[model samples]
Target: MKLLIEGGRRLQGRVRISGAKNSALVLIAASAISGGEVILDNVPKISDVLTQLEIVRAIGGRASWTGENTLCLDWSGPLEGELPYVHAKKLRASNLFLGALAARQKRVKIPLPGGCNIGSRPMDLHLKGFHLLGYQVSMKHGFIEARAGKIEGNRIYLDFPSVGATENIMMAAAGTPGITVIENAAREPEIVDLAGFLNAMGGRVRGAGTDVIKIEGVSEFRGARFSVIPDRIEAGTYLIAAGISGGEVTVENVITRHLQPVIAKLQDVGLDVAAGEDRITVRRRGDLLPTDVKTLPYPGFPTDLQSPMMALLSLARGTSIIVENVFENRFQVADELKRMGAKIRVKGQTAVIEGVERLYGTQVRATDLRAGAALLLAGLAAGGVTEILQAELIARGYEKVVEKLGALGAAVRVAGDESGEPGAKSV
Candidate 1:
């Protein structure tokens, strides 16, 4: 599918934030180890979430949506030990089942995961953690096989604070027989949400939002109910959308504390940013100020929002520098932005962008999930019409982007069916 956007439209209104996609995936994977029904509220109906649920169903589990934003998963049946390649090949989060399945069935055979071609996202840390838990891990014929008579808890330290490794280790260790202490664990808000879900199911976990997380193994997990946190990346993207379009937009249902770094960066760029208890309002004050950004872990500038911020910085009055520290190929959007007449130079992990007076619209392709969002924001701020190809990448993360942009008064719509020519149109 493609997105057709008419540029130069001021987006002004209030839009409610959806649940975090990162949190929803981990929560759904954690449901596989539950003993009863797991009910999750405020879940985003994105393609990634649906794909993860399909993997669960393929393993003899049942998942269904009871409401628009609510999901009920029943995994009490006898689940299969091997994860099918057909379902596991669609998403990166499919690797999360390694730990859940190992904990439940004590044996797992899953294909090497696939997602956006962003960079070398290795699964070494995850495999190492599994080995430490007494699982015999092997890889051959493009599949990972792990088997163990029993999962034993032990102290494991990650060389880097990887979010997937932390979540997988925590889930696998939840059903073991001893204490598992994870050093240098990821401190993202999604990690905290997963810990909360496990705890609600009678799992003992401590220090989730900190670097060191300790989990005591339990014999079983009961069904539990939990709500996901608001998506900070989506909130940051919409806030930058308001800045790029020179409009005022209020985003509600967000946790203010989770966006301090993003709010600080927007303030540094001379945007009018205000935060209340659970909402934030952003408006373009005047000419934007050029700023430098470096992507880091949580409590710092997020790597997920770096691309969208680059789109807004393209229209600033001075030169801006961006250093992407997370993913090596994250700057793939720079070439797409250059297609729209923006001055951007990328060398290795750094990008030098010289602000231009205005950007002319052109056809661009989305390289990844966040890159898709960056292209959309640039299209909204460009001078003419812009058509975005491979917009399915955006739907994997963002929920109802066309409908949300419309509610905020932007002229954007999805064009072309699976058998039609790609095109754009104004709504």
Candidate 2:
């Protein structure tokens, strides 16, 4: 599918942020460790979530949505340890099941997971953690097979603080026989949410939001209810959209603390930002100031919001520089932005963007999830009409994106089909 956007519309309204996709995926995978009804609230109905739910069902677990944004997963039945290639090859979160399955059934066979072609997201850390837990890991015919007679808890240190690796190890260790200490663990809020879910499932976990996390093994799990955190990246994207369109927008249902770095950068770029208890109001007063940004882990500028910030910086009054430290191919959106008459030069992980007076809309392609969102923001800020191809990539992350933008009064709509023609309703 494609998105047809008539540019130069000022977006003005309140937008409620959806639940964090990152948090929800890990929670869904963690549900496999328990054999009861687990209720997840504030879950976004996105493609990625649906894909994860499908995987849950394929593994003999029952998952259904009881409300518009709530999911109920029942893992009371016997689950199949093997994950088919067709199911695992669609999303990166499939790798999360490795830990949960090994903990539950002592074996798992899953293919190498796939997602956006951003960079090399190797599963070595996940596999290494499994091996440390006494699992025999092997690869044959593009599938990973792991078997363990007993899961033993041990102290494992990750070379890098990888979020996926941290969540996998934490979940796998929740059912071991002893205590597991993970040093250099990821400190993202999503990891904290995973720890919270595990704890609610009768698992003992401590120091979740810190670099060192300790988990004591448990013999069984009980179903629990939990609510996912709001998506900070989505809130940041909307805030940047307001800046790019020179409009006023209020993003609601967000934890402002999770967006400190983004808020700081937006203010540095001369945007008027005010944070309330659960909402953030953003307004653009005059010309925007150019700024430099470097993506980092939690408590720093997030890599997920880097592309959207680049879109806003493309229209700044001066030059701006962005260094992507997380993903090597994250700057793929630079070429798409250049297609819209923006001056951007990318060399390796660094991008030099010279602010243009105005951007003219043109046909562009969505390279990845966040990159697709950046293109949409660029389209809204451009002078003429913009057609974005492969908008499905955007839907994988953003929930009802066209509808959300339309609610905020942006002149954007999904194409009727792949022909790039606008319709009365969005996809």
Query: Each candidate: RMSD to true structure?
Result: 2.6, 1.9
Candidate 2 per-residue C-alpha lDDT over 395-424 given as tens digits, one digit per residue, 9 for 90 to 100: 888887777888888888776644433334
- Model 2 misplaced regions, further than 4 Å: 417-427
Top candidate by lDDT: 2
Q: Can you give the TM-score per candidate against the true fold?
A: 0.96, 0.97
For model 1, residues 144-164, the per-residue Cα lDDT tens digits are 988885677899999989999
* Clash count in backbone of candidate 1: 0
Each candidate: what lDDT?
Answer: 0.90, 0.91
**Count: clashes, candidate 2:** 0
Q: lDDT, candidate 1, residue 114?
A: 86
Flag clash pairs in model 2.
none
Query: For residue 2, what is the lDDT in candidate 1?
Result: 82
User: Candidate 2: what lDDT?
Assistant: 0.91
